[model samples]
Structures are given as C-alpha cells and as structure tokens.
Target: MAKFQSLKEAVAENLRDGDTVAFEGFTHLIPHAAAHEAIRQGIKDLTLIRMTPDIIYDQMIGMGLAKKVVFSYAGNPGVGLLRRMRDAIENGWPRAIETEEHSHAAMANAYEAGAAGLPCAIFRGYRGAGLREVNPNIRSVTCPFTGEELAAVPAHRPDVAFIHAQKANRRGDVLIEGIVGVQKEAVLASKRSVVTVEEIVDDFDDLHPNLCILPHWTVTSIVEVPGGAHPSYTHGYYDRDNAAYLEWDRVSADRDLFTAWMKENVLDAGPEIFAARVKEL
Candidate 1:
C-alpha cells in the first residue's frame, strides 16, 4: 500500500545508490520535485531511465547523481541542447557517465514488456535507425511463424520509478488526467515507486473515463507536492513554466551559474517552496 510520506523520507527509504531508477513523465507531470528531493538527499550512482530526458535529468546528471542514463531522445524541449548532459558526456564535468540509447518505440515496448513480466521486448523497429550500432542491447530475433526479422531489447525493469500526477485520493489511488505518457508502465515495471501529486483529494469525484489511475497497492509512497512538475505542466493545475525552461539554457551553460542556481533554488528549497513556485508560474 502507498504510505503518505515526505519526499525526503520516501527517497531515503525506497531509493538507493547504484539502483536503476526511472523518473518518467512526458511534457506533463514530470516529477521535478521528487528528482530534486533525490538530489537534496545526495543519492548517487543511479542508473537513470527516461524516454525524452529534459532539464530535470540534466540537473541530476550535473550533480553527479547518475552513472548511466537510458533514454531515446535527450534535449531541453523547445530550447537547445541539454548543456549539462553534454558536459558530462563530452567533458566529464562531475563524472563520466554511460548511456544506452534506443528509439521511442523500443523504449515504450521495453517498459510494457517489463510491466508484463517479460524478459525482453520484441518489436519491428531499428530498420534504418543507427541506434543499434551504438547500443549493443539492440538485437534481432526471428519470428517463429513468419520467419521475419524483428528487433529486440531488454525489458526496462527499474528498481524505482518516480512520477508526478494531478491527484491522489484519500484511498491513495493516483489520478493522471493529462497527456499520459509511459508513467503507468514505468511504475508497474519497477520494484518500487514514488509519486508526487498536486493534492490529496477526498475522492476522484468527476474524473473522466480516459484518465489513468494506479491503485494504492502499486505505489510505495506518495508525497503531496504542489507544482511538483514545474516547467512541465500538470493537466488541471497549472501552465508550463516556459520562462524557466528558456532560462535553463543560459543557467546550465555556465558551470558556476548552474551549481549556484541548484544550490539556491533546488538544494536549499523544500515542499513549501515548490508550492510557491506553482503559484508564481
């Protein structure tokens, strides 16, 4: 069952060094606050997983928390390159990190396979993509029935998964009402899971049929963190903090500026700060 806890306690108890972790969200409901909590707690050597890695991952990498990043596309959204990610990969600023790149389809399939308790994900992809050459994990399998070739990759089973959602009811069930990404599959595929939400409501009284809900049994902990996804909007709560995303391009370009910004804004900040950030955004 999901225990309501502080972000600090949840990360401290459930996450560990050298664990494979996935902080998943698409353009919406990204768990920026939970990621910051992990950073604040000084978690290290994590094998981070995501689909399209953005600013939050960049910050984590710059802080030297991640040893490996498994992802498909990596950028700062509408902005330019993720400078911190590039610095680590190219200049090895904090530390040298490893990467396992894949296509979007492959990653989605891998997560689904992991959620289904399968060993690997088989799909038709990498036909013309160069990801196979860069990643040895991309292998080919023969279809038993048709004798056709197919692509295969290892299942993405993480030790822990972090996500942000719109709400969790008193029963601890999470409701995601926005643009749903691979958050559901990522949580189901993990050994443990943590969720940060906008509010804990009495019930999901007027939820639409298309919204996704994870039963309490599936989550390890839930942290009530408003604006948990700042810069990445939650469906019903707020708009995307576009200026922050744009400013990241400049702040992240300079090492000293990046460190100072993190120390003041993220490292020293807490849940109340996160709530205020939402209001300001």
Candidate 2:
C-alpha cells in the first residue's frame, strides 16, 4: 500500500545506487522534483528508464548519476539536443554512460509486457529502422501460428518507478490527468513505485471510472509535492516553464556552466523550493 511520505524519505527508502529506475510522465506531469531529490541525495550508477528522456535525465547524466539510460527519444523536449547527454556519449564528460535505444512503439509495448509479467514484448516495429543493427535487444521472433516475424524487446521491469500526478486521495490512489503515457504500466511493472502529487484530497468525487488512477495497492509511497513537475506542466495546476527549457540549452552547453547551475539550483536547493517555484508560475 502507498504510505504518505516526504519526497526525501521516499527517495531514500525506495531508490538506491545501481538500481534500475523509470521516471516516467510523457510531456506533462514529469517528476522533476523527485529526480531533483535523487540528484541532491547523490544517488549513483542508476539505470534510468524513460520513454522520452528530457532535461531531468540530462541533469542526472551530467552529474554522473546514470550508468545507463534506456529510452526511446532523448532530447530537451521543445528545445534542441540534450547537450549533456550528447557530451557524455561523445566526450565521456563526467562519465561514460551506456545507452539502449528503442522506438516509441517498442518502449510502450515493453512497458505493457512488463506489467503483464511477460518476458518480452513482440511488436511490428524496426522493420526498416537502423536500431536493430546497434541495439542487441532488438530481435525478431517468428509467430507460431502465422510464421510472421515480429520485433521483440525485453520487458522493462525496473527496480522502481517514479511519477508526478495531479492529486491523491486519503486512500493514496493517485490521479493523473491529461496526456497519460506509460506511467501506469511503468508503475505496475516496477518492484516499487513513488508518486508525487499536487495535493492530497479526501476523495475524487464524480471522477470518471475510466480515468487514470493508480490504486493504492500498486503504489508504494506518495509525496504531497505541489509543483512537483515544474518545467513540465501539471494539468489544471500550472503551465510548462518554457523559459526554463530555453535556459537549459544554455546552462547545459558548457561543462563549467552546467556544474555551476547544478551546484546552485539543485545541490544547494531542496524539494521545498519546487512548491515556491509553482507559486511564481
């Protein structure tokens, strides 16, 4: 069951060095605060997983926290390249990080397969793609019935999954509104899950039955963190911080600037600052 805890406590208990963790949210509700907390705690050698790895992964990778990154797309979102990630791959700055790339379809299916307790996810992808040449995980399986070859990738069963949501009730059921991604499957597929929410309400009254709600049984811990997804918008809570995304392109470009930025903004700051940032938005 989900126990209410601070972001610091949740990260300390559920995440650790050399663990495979998925911090998922898609375009919105990205768990920036939780990732920041992990950075502040100086967790290292993490195998980070995400469908779309943006600035947060860039920060983690830049800080030499990630030993490997498993993902579909890697970038700064609306901005240009993830300079830090590129630097790590190209120059081995901070550290050399291994990368496993996949397509959007493959990643989504892999997460789903993991949630279903499957060993691998088979989908019709990478037909003419170059990922198969480099990624050993990309292989083909012949269908037993039809003899059709399908792409197969190992399921993403992470040590823990982290996500940000709009709200959670007293029961600890998390509500994720707007642009849902593989967060649900990521949570269900993980050994443990941490959720940060904008607020904790008594109940979700008149909510649609089909809405995305991770039952308390599926969640291990919940942190009440308003603006936990800052820089990434939370539905009905705040807008995406476009300026931050723009500024990251500058901060992450130079090694000295990146280190200084992390020292001042992340190393020196705490999770409490995120709530204050949301007030300004």
Candidate 3:
C-alpha cells in the first residue's frame, strides 16, 4: 500500500462525515492539529471522542463540524468555557452524549480490547459514580468469570485516530515521552491512524527505543510539519502558549466571537498563518 505523503492528505483521506474519531492529547499537548485542518477543509458531522475537549474541539463544534462528542469534559483550551457545547445542549442542536469523567479510562480500556480483538474488558473503578449516571454508554454487568459486578467496557473501534508527536519517521513511527495512556489505545483501536510531528527524523534508531510510542507499522500516514502543535506544546520542543489559552478562555464566552477568531486564525489560515498569529500574541 502507498503510504500517505502528507499529514493534511492523511487526515483528508481517513476522516469522513459522521465518522467516530479519537483525538489524542491532554489540555495542550500533542493535539490533533491536522484533524482540525481536515475539518477546515470541509469534513463535517464528526463524532469526536476524547478524554477532554479543548479549543480545537470547541472550534469544530462551533463551526458545526461535529455531530456528536463523547468526552469527559468540554471547555476552553484550559479554563472552563463550553460556549458551543452548552449551546448545542441547550438548543438540542446535535446529538450530545455526555460520559463520566472516568469515561476516559473506560474508553481507553475499550480501545485496548478492540486492539486485542476481544469482545470486551472488565475493570473495576468508580462503580456507581456520578459519571455512570451521566454516561449511559457504559454498562454494569455481572462478571462472567467471578460472578461479581463489573464494568464491562465495550470495544471502541474508531474510524480514525489523530495525534501529534514530538518526532516521527516518514513511515509513521512516533516518538513521545511520558505516559501515553489512552493515546496508545486510540491508535490501536482505530482502523486508520494519522499523526502530525514537529519533525521527521531520518531514522527511528536516533531516539531511545522505549521512547517510541506508536510504531510505523500501525500508522497509516506521517506528515512533517514544523511547529505543528502551536499553542499546544510538544514537550521538549516548546512550551504551551498559556497566554493564548487564557485569551481563548476569555473570549470563548461568546460563541460568535470565538467562532470568528477560530475562522480567522485556524480555519482560514494554515500552519504558517497560525504561526504568525501566535507570535503576535
């Protein structure tokens, strides 16, 4: 099979309307920038799955790109301002599915099960919690082996998984530091995976073997974009634009203003435009 030549192309090729996509990143690290690019390119009706929804998710939701969202929390890049999400819920615009905060771990477990080709996985944590009441997707069932109550998280086979990495090869080998957690599971469970990297190294052996999170074999496309994770740092490469995040929080209270800002900064422009805009901030 021909490998993807660019991150933008990879996202455009893999993502479709109404497809379930798992975005990897937390707060402002290793975000799905390329996925947002794809959305700007006119992909719509996306069902975004993530542990937390930030500015990117909010932008997409506000632009009417997202049809559904499964996440623990939805807010500004960092602070709490879910203007678009609140609008959708209050007006009943789209299908808004709210999951428990633990739903992040549950979805991760489900992705692991899907990657392992198992029907489901049973784990014990936060039983009868407030999250359970909000997230109807999760089910409590009797453990087949132990006859004890357990949370049987179903497999989460997403249509695509989009993540950003510190480094990668042309073949799509990704290198990231610290705990991967749900990101690894998302890559495993998704049928197609696309990643944006700060730089494409010549060889995977250039870094410590253990630092390699997603191997080339699992990735379908590798796009090399310097400073791809702008605003959202890439650990060791740059620090997050905390001031920018703060501004996002301040302006996100107004959906119109937030949408206009996003269109001017993220949607109407590409990485180059965003880079310049960020520098001005």
Candidate 4:
C-alpha cells in the first residue's frame, strides 16, 4: 500500500496546514530532509509530536510552522537548549506556540498505547511531579484489579508521521537498523506515514527477519533520500554532523541569523544537497 514517491511529492500530498504531525526519530535517523521539504513547501500551524524534540523541531518552530508541540524533553541533544523553541515560547518572534510536556516513560507508553489502538496510556508515573498539577491530560485512573492509582495520558495518534530509515526494499518495506526508538510505534499509530530512506534495495534478503521492518502496508510513501538524515547519522551510511549541530546553536540563537540560515540552506536548497553533504563524511 506504500507508494514510492519523491520527497517533495510525498510531503505535498501527505502533509497539509494545521495537521498534527510527528517527525519521530531519536538521536539518530532524524528526518531532516523531509522536515526541510515541508518547510520549503510552507507547511504551517502543525501540532508537532515527538519524544525528544531536537534541532529539526527547532527549525520548524523557528519558521513559524508549529502551533503547538507535544513532547517529553526538548533540547539540542549534546549541545544545549533549543534557542528557537525558547524564542518562540518566550519572545514570540515568529508566533506564540503552546506546549504539552510529559515524562519520557509516559511518551513511550502513549505511543505504544496508540499503536495498540488504546484510548490512553496507563502507567505508574508523575509521582510527586508538578506536571500533574499543570497538564490536564495527566490524569489518574484507579486500577480495576487493585485499589492502587495510576497515571494516564492520551495516546499520540498523529495525522502523519515522518521517519528516516536505512533502506527500503522495492516492495516498500522499510528497514530501520540502529536505535529504532519509537519510530515503529509512531508509524503504526499514525493515520499516515512518510519514510525517507538512504537507498532502495532489491530486497532485504540477508537482513535478519527479527530486524525492525515496517511492512509496506503501514507506510503511505517511501522516498529514496540518500543522506536525508544529515546532522543526524544514519547507521552504516554516514556519521552525525556534530559540527553542524554546534553551528546551529549559534545560528539559532539569533532570529535574524536563524531566518537567514533557513533561507539559504533549506528554502534555496533541495533534497539533492543532502547527498552532497554526506559525501565527505
């Protein structure tokens, strides 16, 4: 059921204004190219979802594309704070954005619950945490079997989920090799999914059957985008561009600099630039 399409075509066809989208990737295999394409296409007012919102989210937020962000932790990974996100929240440079914070465990459970088609994720968390006092979604449910109380959060059923995988076979089955994270559950939980991969192989013949493989039926689009996860490494394909991440902390610290960087690197550039970026790496 997955159609092979270009990144531009996939983004345009699948993503739209005011959609609740999740670009789910951990420290690795982040879908930077797809996010850039969405930015170039001028997608706006998204309710973004992720476990750890990193630089990719920062770019989208800085560009005034996000109306709200649902996440557990947000930062620049090893570098520092997400300046753009902070700016949007504090100064409202582009526009004001709302935030829903949660624990990492709750987010994982929420994604799993969504994948299981559950209404909410029930887990033992938020104990002594102030998040319960602030977030209305963080509610308590009494155990049916026991008299104990538990925490519950709404499941993340996004309109569309985006991820970068290592490879996809001709049948559109995607192979996600390293640090799978919640990419699988995110895709399964979403109404639609767009996957960008390093390459398209004839088939995943030699790979183990137990590997993290999303069947063609689960994905809406499979796009061959070499070096698509630049700045975030694709296992076995390229190394993480740490220098770029560091530079982003500087570039994003200033509104003018952030806009200029985005215009030059993302707006003026295309997916082809990603391939060139990793050629020397």
Q: Rate the local accuracy (lDDT) of all candidates.
A: 0.93, 0.94, 0.70, 0.95
User: How many backbone clashes does every candidate have?
Assistant: 0, 0, 0, 0
**Residues 130-230, candidate 1, lDDT per residue (tens digit)?**
88788999999999999999999999999999999989999899998769999999999999999999999998777786679999999999999988898
Per-residue lDDT tens digits of candidate 3, residues 128-198?
67877766666778877788888876677889988777777655678877545467777888898877777
> After superposition, which runs of candidate 1 have C-alpha atoms over 4 Å from their true positions?
none
Clashing pairs in 1: none
Best candidate, TM-score: 4
- The RMSD of every model to the true structure, in order and in angstroms, is 0.9, 0.8, 2.7, 0.7
Ranking by TM-score: 4, 2, 1, 3
Against the true structure, candidate 1 reaches a TM-score of: 0.98
How do the candidates rank by lDDT, highest first? 4, 2, 1, 3
| Number of the candidate with higher TM-score, 1 or 4 | 4
Query: Best candidate, lDDT-wise?
Result: 4
User: On a 0 to 100 scale, what is the lDDT of residue 156 in model 3?
Assistant: 74
TM-score of each: 0.98, 0.98, 0.88, 0.99
Error of 2 at 75 (Å): 0.8
